[model samples]
Target: MTVALTTPMLLAAGPAHALLPNRSCGTVTSADSTAAANLNKVLTGKLRGSMTAYRLSCARAIADATRARGLPNQAAVIAITTAIVESVLENNPNKIDQTSVGLFQQLDHWGSYEQRLDPAWSTNAFLNEMVTLYPNNSWQNQQIGVVCQRVQRSAYPSRYQPEVADAQRIFNALTAPAPASKVHLEIVGADGGMWNTDGDYAAGEWSGSWASLGGTGLKALASAVTGNTMHVYAVGSTGRVFTKDANYSTGQWSTDWAEVPGNIQGATALTASVTGNKVHLEVIGADGAMWNTDGDYAAGEWSGSWASLGGTGLKALASAVTGNTMHVYAVGSTGRVFTKDANYSTGQWSTDWAEVPGNIQGATALTASVTGNKVHLEVIGADGAMWNTDGDYAAGEWTGSWASLGGTGLKALASAVTGNTMHVYAVGSTGRVYTKDANYSTGQWSTDWAEIPGNGAGATALTASTTP
Candidate 1:
């Protein structure tokens, strides 16, 4: 029997009904930032006209709905496209349609009027409908038309095909191929920025700033940015590393500024990870050497022990870590990319730098997940283009050829990954952040970028999930 739900009951139980299966897009568990960059260029080019607003709103609504359910953070292209085809998301606002209204155009009689108008409620209902209809099929793999028909059963099912392509295009613009273990950060200003830091471990649509930690001449450059449960770590002026941690439980932030203890000519960049609650920070020391630390991110523990990973061409950049291996790559003084992977399991890091097949001038990023047997990397070419590399971390098979992903407005930025999709997000020189995703189906990148809600070169973290 169908149970009647009151407004309070429905609101309280919203998390159980969102679109994502198990409702959590596992943290950026795997990624292909290089592919993500390429797709961003493609999708940005595709977004235009009336389609732009509808597509954006759809994607935004789906993302919001997923978050409301406490489900894994999902990119919104699929549900957005579904709405684009179903209702064009343009029902009259002044007058109500008893049959359907809002983004999904839900029929009012099917549920409460309030629920029908709510973005989260509509998306959750749609996802639940899909699950009830196709309990065993893989929604991610099914053709768009097939998946849509399974849920909508529209009179002209075939008419929905074009929207599937639209959905796929948007999906590729949103889903990440892997996790963001390494991110490129560049601080453009000291203006306190407003952001949501509690979830996704990132700053979104920034505005306003924290209490000023006075340090003028805050020149920003491309540096490695990493995170832990309680703090964000980045390279400060003159190559010093700085950290800011929060005690959300206590609604407090540590005010003490502890400088990285290291004798260096200058610091280049920083990368870090949190494993079993311990924060690990890695950076290029003043002598053009690699330095690392293992300490309490919340309590501020950094040893500043310097470890030299030898190579003549080090241009201090970013690094990403998995299981026990840390993949470090950078743009050399000569503009070529030099990479090394530290395998903690063997108690030894790679002794020699293996050159990735391109000349990079910015930080390189990497990410991986269990579903894929590979690690993926992305870097900015000396030509200001983005290039990518994929390798089998466990099999020791490396693919080092560089492929060009074109974009004109991208600046130094950060990325995160999930599954076989790579989400590359970058701030435009115009101060707008853009995003695009690369999927495995076409084995190619989307040709445009979608505008994000805010600005800043800090980082654009991503995660994804699918409902049954």
Candidate 2:
């Protein structure tokens, strides 16, 4: 029953174990950007203290651990409060009491030194014992000090209670509700500046006039709303990808356009989608391959530099997310539509660009409008007319056929679903913006493309973000 795990065997096997807690933080791979941001703001406001980034990261680690365990905010608050008192919100760098360690200062009885030192393992072990003692979530009704004392058996249980107010404040600030969910349409105006407009898509009304975000030499654009902020990305004509964030709740954007790390030279198309905590951004880079990156919007950083999702001769691209699965669609060299997927939950992808079975070949460009588990894929047909197909994420099936939306010369496409309706925005060859709607319940497309009251034209790209 005991097989030795040799160096090679252990090296290969350990990553899966390591990644388990790392990925399960609220169905996200769990980036700590928001936690870091919240800590900075709170530390500066009323809890004025010199907290190091390392200590802050430890608190974030506990937050991620609590989320991974599928626990409530109260659990996080209690656990974090305990850590705040026990080890001052950090896994002790130097062991104390000869056997106690980690954020919670877990003792030898908790687990091995290695386990006790891991913020995630110690947090979980504490919870496991806490749950055993307080079955049926009886801990939910108990006082924060009582729960912490029961779990830690601390000598000074009163010490934990005094910290609950700060702990609750930190958790509240970090888990504050995301900005009001609305669709932010960022597009390339005729003058090449980045223009944006917000609409209560769920109500079918624009909130304000389009404002210029001020850019030059930009080519393709992609956008998504994550937390309380809107992230807009664009590739300059020179092929450098740049990004900026507009925190709607704060009513401010990042002071400048920060360049996204990575060269996506000759990017012909750009698309952005939000999945869990990270924003998945990919572009058709030079040599006709898809180069992808994930942005940690809260942390304000880009990771995975440029991972190439090698499909050659790809044309325009579009992506949509349902739950943790991201569906990326692209037009192939032969005019056939192909798609692939990335499951954030399992960190895996479809083996290849599988041909969609609708025989809807000869497609040039496409956009995926996701409502519930359904993806309403709208594409420009070979004849430059609008066509559509549907895919169900829950069932892993696509509609057996493509239907004509009965339009021609549709040049650009972007769609946002609010409530049960899919609002499709397209640009015609005449350089006019038009919108049509599909009511999910009635299964009906609007009678005609109603031109919006805008003379705005000459847009090369469009992207709309709604609540995930």
Candidate 3:
């Protein structure tokens, strides 16, 4: 069945609120003062001489197709390497070789002109055949080139071998775990109104109707993607936590709000992370200490009562889970940053809070994400500037010095790492939304912030996640 892409409908609007900017330590970069810019760009259709663009376009199509079929990265690598050897990853409708065309030079027997020409469709068709040839998951153990050769039955079977390295490089670059797909964005309006975009920032639109599930006095909101579902959590006016679930494949949200079993104070900060099939939530309790709860998605139930993590004077908290290791960060009342580590496999949490070195102090809001073995953190400094610190979680070493990304009047902050790209969303004191993008592998951020439309004044909370 062909899935028709639909535009997301616009949601409800609300009144604006004045939010004070938090002071943070950092030097303002003149480049960051400019208005934000859009980073979403489609690379499909016909390809020219840009090898980088072609590789990215092919990788995206393959990734989407494989994901749809519930296939793994091995299948993606097979499809990409086949395309690289066949047409150098270009979409060539004009190329005529006994009716073969498109990225993989698929023949007429593959499908009709349109179907064969569509990057995603062609890749899907190729993968379906590949899976049929290797249904036992044995393809995972074979050389990528050999797998492609078996599927394509090309006359030059060895041609695919030479492109294996390049194919793997491109696949790794495009498939790195990202906090959210580059195409999706989640926003919380005043009065706890929630909205999300369905497509990429370049072409996606907000939902038409806002779910009135949230209430006034919503202090912090967070989201995480687990399998094919997106989970959103919000702290309502009554100091209670509410959650809503959405099926990313169908773009449908649950009709009612489910209250989480916890008693958090109003204005408490909340952060969420997902590893395997379990969802972890951390928040500042009424006692000003960090508390946590776990949601088992596989079991469809919450586990245990809220457990105290044993830290005092905790203000803002953020958590990141890489595999079974969960890392949590928070700003102490004295303006210092402290971290705790947990290993779920061992069922253990760090014994005590350890201050991050460099004497970094005075951060108001904190957000964190992990890529590989590295942990990246962004904080609202006391000087009202954005400060970022990164370290190797496995090695226990940090950069120590906080690097300034440069923005003023920033109130709320949220971040997600998708593929090899890192995205940070902030609601300025004016209540307008701005975003900055960085290549997570390079640790280089875009110079200017791009303003996201539709999120008008009074965007109190912001969270982001890629569709699973």
Q: Please write out the lDDT profile of model 2 over residues 1-468, one tens digit for every residue.
A: 998977674334453332112212122223345455556656532234644445556666787789998988888888888888887765664565677777777778878877887778888997898889899999999999899998888878787777787787777655655434476777787777787777775465775466788888787788877777778888877877888888877768786887888656677788888875689998998789888888876686779478988899998889988889898999899878888899999988888998877888778778887888988999989888889899987898998799999778888788887767888888778766677889999999898998654456777667776643
Ten contiguous residues minimizing lDDT sum, candidate 1: 459-468
- Per-residue lDDT over 1-468 for candidate 1, one digit per residue giving the tens place of the 0 to 100 score: 998866664335354543321121112212323434444454422232234333344455676675566543322445666676666543222223446665666665547756666667778887777656766535656666666676766666775556655555655555532343322222334342212221132333323221333333332222222232245454556666665544434546566645555543366655655444455566666666666666654465555566666555355455556676667766666657777776656757777778765434454333222225555566655555566676666777767576667665444545555445556655555555566667754566678876553333342222111110
Question: What are the per-model C-alpha RMSD values against the true structure?
Answer: 17.3, 19.3, 18.0
Model 3 Cα displacement at 198 (Å)? 4.8
Against the true structure, candidate 2 has what lDDT? 0.77
lDDT of 3 by residue, 1-468 (tens): 998869887878887665323211122232212210111122222222234433455556776778788887777777878887787766777545788888788888889977887877888888878778888888898888788988888999988877776666666656554334444556677656776654354234444333344445666788877887889898777667888888877867898878887545553878888878889988788788888899999998887578888887788888887668998999999878999988999979999999877677888887887778888888888887788888786786998889889889887788876667777888888877788877977768999987775646677777877652
Per TM-score, the best of the predicted structures is 2
Where does candidate 2 stray beyond 4 Å? 1-181, 202-204
Each model's TM-score, in the order given?
Answer: 0.48, 0.63, 0.62
Q: Over 4 Å off in model 1, which ranges? A: 1-187, 190-230, 246-256, 263-265, 296-300, 357-373, 418-420, 440-444, 455-468
- Model 3 residue 402 CA deviation (Å) reads 0.2
Alpha carbon lDDT of residue 253, candidate 2? 77
